[model samples]
Target: MDKLRSLTLFLATCEEQSFAAAARVCNTDPSTISKAVSRLEAELGVTLFQRSTRQLKITAAGRHYAQTVRSSILALSSCEDELRQLNDAPRGRLRVNSAVCYGHLYLRPLLKAFCQRYPEITLELSLDDMHVDIIEQDIDVALRTGFVKDSRLVARCLSPMDFVVCASPDYLKQHDMPVSLDDFNGHSWIGFKIKETQQLQPIFLPDADGVYQLCELHRTHITDDGEAMAQLCADGFGFAQLPHFLAKAGLKSGALVSLYPAFRAPMPDSGVFAIYPKRAYLPARVRVFLDFLVTALEAQQETPTHTWAQHWPPHVQFD
Candidate 1:
């Protein structure tokens, strides 16, 4: 008289409406099935079945109990299946998409280590500046910067997107360094044009009240590519506002010098995000890769040379 075995027999009896048929389903004799149900009824102090010579009728209470027990058993079975899937070695082709500069500068370097760690996962990475439909492309995951507007995707913020207004040392030598926002009027500016929209990307700067406001500057040079913009700025084109990922290398190498140290661009919907299609059960390969990427980025943040976001002046630090 195991409780679960009794419940299973009760459910089968309720479904079959006959002890003999239930016995057939349970691969036991009718008398054994009847005894199990009788034991369950005795324990619950409720007559589950209205047994007659010709008909075996289930009571309303028996019907309700059967429904509840069936649901519980199904849930338990689903949990067990999920656990088995998790325990299995993750193996699959993991298709990942990313923005061009981010893929090249940040993600490309980590692929070798990721491949070594998860040898079973076949990694397919595609880099594009324009956002692509992941579902249509069958992409498993995508690394994106700035806001994720699609309601169909789940976006996990990996890091904050910080922008630095900087110029190369050679450019700084030729042009007078601006001490204030007003002084920027006389300085040349390099701008990034959005390839998708064919419009110049707006530059936002924090005001005295720490409110971010869009600032319009005369563009001396413009490019659709972030890396190209960073390069132009580094080669003495002009001062440009560059994302931290694109500017980190130059800043560390002294090829670029940050301007307006106290000012920061706190733009809304600005962050580094790992995006994937919304799903009830995320594949193990995608899940492991996401976990690996997060850990790798955290380790990078701890090291001075490989930190994704730059540490500004102590007074201007923000979480």
Candidate 2:
């Protein structure tokens, strides 16, 4: 029972009084923790905790078990730390997840460098636009964009990818250019859809007379792929809004044009971050990848699109 994680978590649940709180401390799911506790109660054939809708009260056996588990876990960690000190290098599989556009547009190069740095570290990279359960998925770290919400993981800001309003050169030349936000009403719009929601997301832009308004978008073409939107917009389909960093190359190479230079409103909360489970010691692989990502993003910002335009293709290299 002492060697089993379910038993250990059962003790943690009784001590914490809440399954969610124990899950956070142990870096697991709340449901998993609760199930473990329930299983422990069934196996022991004693009601370890008195459960009510309002609170969980620990029985005498629960308190005794919690105390015993706490001391034993601590002792095990102390023993493990001495052996870990002898192995200076962190050699393990480091799993990472990121948005598809962000992953290809940014981290591919950075990850290449990271793999070079730590030859022993195996990377399992998953690219998806939707939010994922890092702990449950066994993800070591994630490079995420926009707002950071989870308190269970520690977030480190890597960079801010500024957003912009864009349209195809041909489309802008064919139609009357929108002078202000209210001007958007007359234009055919391409929008981004969050896959998890399967609904169109609002793209905030300055409305009539240059007043920023979070307008509900009525999109003619809405898709989950950011690249698809950009491509469709480039093909003179409709105006699409995208991150400035993403459009910078297209804007330079005469593929896409910034719709409103002055009114390309960037949201204040759109900070890119690297999130990871809260651990006592961050593994070297995670640190190395984060450092590489920061360096790559900073270099991208410092060197203008024209600098890369001469060497690299104008549109997305990967997609």
Candidate 3:
């Protein structure tokens, strides 16, 4: 029996706690895995697991041994990765998770270009609107809007994403463009849910006796989905506070009119973000992608109104 295979088999068995699972990881049969573990136990003169009819439990010695062996395996893998990158070509399948609209509008093209440039690299993309635990999902990178307050990950700022308070031109013509924050209470509101803050921040600006103020409440329409909210507002249902990136075309084409023009509202956070696990020695692929995005975003800021072009792709980027 190969000693490395036996050691890895023992490690996998310790992690998965089942002969079938360990065998699957090792690309062999459960009997092969069991035989390897038995050989390991024989060589070490110690049983690592105390197995029962219904369950498998690690022995006290096994617990300590597993930690040591796991660390060794990780170190070896890291070394292999370093060697791979040092060869001047980083190659692997990187998993990326992001929200729906941003993935479509922004990340899609950038990712496409990246993959085209590096044919050796592949991407597994997950587009979702809900927040998830990055560690639990085994995600290599995540792109999210606004703030991520969890102390576990590192949040990098990409660009200043502002809001556009808008409603379709027809809707505004029919409904009163209430002149004050208090006036917004009576008007229909389209609420956008902020995952980071866990808050529904709508676009409601009002003048409190000649003084400008922000109205973040009195939501008549609330949805966790942004695309649906935008459609409803575009169809003349109500006012929707949308990201500048998402609302530009509608505003420019006269389909939607920007509301509260005089008083501008702070974005609360950046729309473009590059998030990753907070640890030293970042992966080459992740670093390259992050740098590429930051550069692309800066190029976009110099020409601010490009997002309003009808021909412009949903995610505004240089083609």
Candidate 4:
């Protein structure tokens, strides 16, 4: 007989006080229970029970053994329960990545609420603008702005990359705000340079025909950092077209002023997206985080329609 099975049968027989009764409880024959307990007593070199034809009574050794093994049995049952919970609930270390500005401005606040709701989930978040290989870096989810070209990954749109032209109050006070596209001709511009291509990031604006056009601005100051460009714009360095994530608060607090509220930029594919690797079964934690992020970002916007404008033409580009 197996040792664990023998121990269980022995304990049941001891507690029930009769082999026949223990067999009834265990759904086994009385002879099987009798043999298992006899084997257990032999292995332990202890007389566990004193049996007579009329009644069966447990020895002192049998009572002591039952008391000792009861705690171990309870602990084993508790471990099984924990394993079951691990399979059903979202409770584990979750790795996530996001761009610096968006992480700080939007994701940072949402994290507190998410943690509070799911206290069992441990989160590891990395905030940076540098491109990362999610598989290589072991990242479970990534919040990025712009095109997601990797076929190995699945992308979900979080918000539109609505470019808004803004300038510091000091700069606008010193120089007139550009009301038309032509007014940008001689103004000092703070621009963004592509890190990989080393070329000026294309500025998309509308033409006289209401169609979108791209103009590569000649910049007096350029950087590959989004936050730096926004800061320079706020510090009165020059005018910059910044994403709403970086420019919204400054515009509201009067540190920066928006130019041409009616004109919208053309960025069909340049939207904030959450990317994750293609997998047959995505973890429960990742799915919950992605859904929570979308809800949190929407709460900060004026309206869903305004946050994602639909007037831009489909895949329009300029050579």
Candidate 5:
């Protein structure tokens, strides 16, 4: 009789409390279960059960041994599961979540290529402007902008977020271009409202010393959506501070003009991140998706489509 097989049979007998019941559960004869338990008892130098014709009763020592063996079996099973996951091919449903604007501008374009590369992975993407609980939502991975403070998650910085103060060409033509921070006094402002907090996002302006300071500007137009806010600004509403990802197209197409490109907010939450729940073993699907996204983003940086850093002064360095 194999030792592991004997242990398994012994545990089954302990759980069932009857050789016949254990035999039925293990798909063997009652005699086999009895022999395995008897051998286990002899090896341990203790009588594990008080067997009578009517019922089988476990001793205190048997109960304690069962508890120990159960935990060891569970630990062994967990190790085997982790090893299997590590070696398994990437094939499963991968649930991904992303912020709305970033998903539209960046992630959406790369989906087809990712799917073509990993045909085995079924991709399910959810785009929301509001933050979500990845663990509760059963999300495998998430793309988020700004600083991630959740202790339960692991965040990798995909790119640095840059905000550009911009206005439509018509608006800049009508109003004096803000050459200095003092010139912002009478200018109309278009602000972005955070739907979650129901508060307007703060505007950070650089002082004469180039230090960013939060300033309150009267908002002439406000919207929770980044695209809508950019549209309102482009339609000659007011000066707005927009994320580079949102402002890039407008600036390139000559719809919007970058105002005070030298001054930028040193926001604490200033990076686009790839976020996921921390685990001992990462699934192959998730690992491949992250790798694909990183590679794609790196390729985009090599082209003019995502040249966000080019808008900044040459002296500034980003990681």
Candidate 6:
């Protein structure tokens, strides 16, 4: 008698509480399920179930044993999946989820190149600023920042989400440019009301020495969207602490000016991470894309934009 097979049959019987039901679930005869459960009981030297013609009942020990058996079976299944994935090619639809600003600033630029490189893989990208359940939504990958508390997902750090306090050149010219930490208290701020929490997020800034100061910013204008807040700041609303990815283009274009660039420090729990659902067998397409992103992001950090064009495939073009 196969011990694993017998254990599986026993667990199925415990769940359904009927040999016939377990048989239907396992696609086997009722007698086979019954014999397997009986064999399992004999091997364990325990009567796992109290059986009768009318109904079957699980013992107290059986209930406790089922819990352990279920976990072991799941681990075995995951191992089997991993083994199968080892031989599988990287062709398939790779579903990705990301925030809007990150998608536009970071991911959107890379898609054409990624598609060209992996012609067999089809990319299905979904953008939403709000957090969605990755497993429930069937998203293969998610580009996200900040702390990840989900135990069911694997988060690989790509970059630090460096927060840059900046505003429009016109706004800074109208008001005093924040030269010191004490100067921020005198300034009005464009506040971001978080959609998830519905509260105005406190501004956290760091100085040259890497010490952080928290500010309960005086909100002159409020919006739930990060992009909207950035646009408002660029339109000369007030000072806003924006993520570097969102502010980089504006800074380069002279639409926004970085306030105290020398004072920038790493924000706590702030990271750009490629998050994916935890699985033993990560699809090859998803794995390669993640590797590509890590390499691309590293190059983007090290090389200047004009120089980055040289790294691209000759047939691919970027502006």
Please list the residue runs of candidate 1 whose C-alpha ends up more than 4 Å from where it truly belongs after superposition: 1-84, 206-212, 262-266, 302-310, 313-319
lDDT, candidate 3, 65-112, per-residue tens: 777776565556556666676665756778899878888767787877
What's the TM for model 1?
0.68
Between 3 and 6, whose TM-score is larger?
A: 3
* Model 3 clashing-pair count: 2
lDDT of each: 0.78, 0.70, 0.69, 0.75, 0.79, 0.75
Most lDDT-accurate candidate: 5
In TM-score terms, candidate 3 sits at 0.68
Worst 10 residues of 5 by lDDT: 310-319
TM-score of each: 0.68, 0.67, 0.68, 0.65, 0.68, 0.66
Tens-digit per-residue lDDT, 81-118, candidate 6: 57778686677788899888889888999999999999
The lDDT, on a scale of 0 to 1, for candidate 2 is 0.70
Task: Rank the models by lDDT, top first.
Answer: 5, 1, 4, 6, 2, 3
Report the C-alpha lDDT of model 1 over 210-310, residue by residue, as the tens digit.
56679877887888999999999989988898988888788878788776442335567667888887665577888889898888888768231224445
Encode model 2's per-residue lDDT on 4-60: one tens digit a residue. Answer: 698677766765788888899789988888778777778888777888888888899
State the lDDT at 181 in candidate 6. 69
Candidate 5 regions exceeding 4 Å error are 1-81, 85-87, 262-264, 302-307, 310-319
RMSD (CA, Å), each prediction: 15.6, 8.8, 6.9, 18.9, 12.5, 10.1
Give the worst 10-residue stretch by lDDT in candidate 1: 310-319
Better lDDT candidate (3, 4): 4
